[model samples]
Target: MRTCMTVRHGAERRTLMMTGAKLVLMRHGQSLGNEANLFTGWNDLDLSANGHEEARRAGRLMRHHGFLFDAAHSSMLKRTIHTLHHCLDELDQSWLPEYRSWRLNERHYGALQGLNKDDTIARYGREQVQQWRRSFDVTPPAVKPDSPHHPGNDPRYASIPRCDLPCAESLAMTMKRVLPYWQDMLLPALRQGQSLLVITHGTVMRALIGHLDGLSPEETQTLEIPTGTPLVYEIDKAGAVHRIGYLLPPT
Candidate 1:
């Protein structure tokens, strides 16, 4: 049976289904870094041509499924921001309120930012690289504070505390930053019964999914999150969040 519930958006009120608040999580489409097989981290690269198409297709898929959102959130990175815009455009929801934060960014890769992944594997043994890439607590080497790859060098992060800036991060470290945003912002909004769209990076999305689904570190490491796919979840009244399915096949 279908039920309806009232949700508030600032001063505006919206009536939505009581099935539970729907939350959609998506990773940005292929970025230049991805196409070049580079360790992107938080380098803030733009999407490639194929990525643009992927974004549009993801949007169309959601629209075909009759998905609508009250608000959206994304990382401060342009790739995610652009993908969100493309998806919103296709859904005819360009006016939706958007919130962006650094906490939603990809794991900081430190000195690996522009290096080709294969080359890195060659320099560091495959097993070592794998550990850095897949281990829950093994962080990549830290970049020097003066390095161009460091977050401290970016003007966008000037307001952030100097101590909070990361030179490199493990999945565990990324989760530490991501969980706060979920607990402080997303969870409350979900409880308020507002449907939300979150466009973020692969590692950040994995961190979130790990928390929501209570996946172990090993399990999360093995999980592959495809880019440009919408992962839908329904939050019950008791505050449990579980996946419904992806809007597309998740290829």
Candidate 2:
């Protein structure tokens, strides 16, 4: 049976009628980038055929275990958005409120956005590529303002100030931007006793999970969140968050 507890959200107090507030943090299913082993960043690729299956399986797994969510969120990229929709469809909760934001997009890979991983490593040396891919503060080379790979060139980001768009992002830089969304969006919802599903990109997931778990920089750098697997967390009575393990065995 679910337990209930009184929680305070600012001046207002609400009764949370469950064991605790739960959250599902999932990386989007395999995209064209994953299938091709390319640096996708915010390239907005579509899901591969296997990606669709993985997302559906995640949904089925959640459903089998009686997971329910009050709202869902994803990055502005289609791979994540489509993965979310597929999961929601399988959950039979297609009408759930959905929020999307560029803040949740993958860590911008700058000039490396479309390059194959192996080729990039071959050209740049594996150590350099590894540093760019895994270091907490080492940003990849920046894309020129006029480069097609830059987010500034994308119509969807036109409304955002040019200064807010990233040319490249280290894991630290990605975490900096992602934290605001957590404070301004997800935190408020969680305080209201809401169960949420957040489907986003791999690097973004690492950044977020790192912050949520209060990991050291070295630990965060090595963290790996598998695509399409749901990592669960719970907020305790005192509002401290704890990892509850993944819902299904990662494929």
Judging by lDDT against the true structure, name the best candidate: 1
lDDT of 1 by residue, 138-241 (tens): 99999999998899889999999989989999999999999999999998898888889999999998899899988998888777888998877788666788
Prediction 2 global C-alpha lDDT: 0.86
Q: Each prediction's Cα lDDT score?
A: 0.87, 0.86
Give the residue spans of candidate 1 off by over 4 A: 1-18, 249-251
- Model 2: per-residue Cα lDDT over 26-138, one tens digit each: 99998989999999999989999999999998888777666778999999999999999999988999999999999999999999999999999899999999999999999
TM-score of every candidate: 0.91, 0.91
The alpha-carbon lDDT assigned to residue 204 of candidate 2 equals: 84
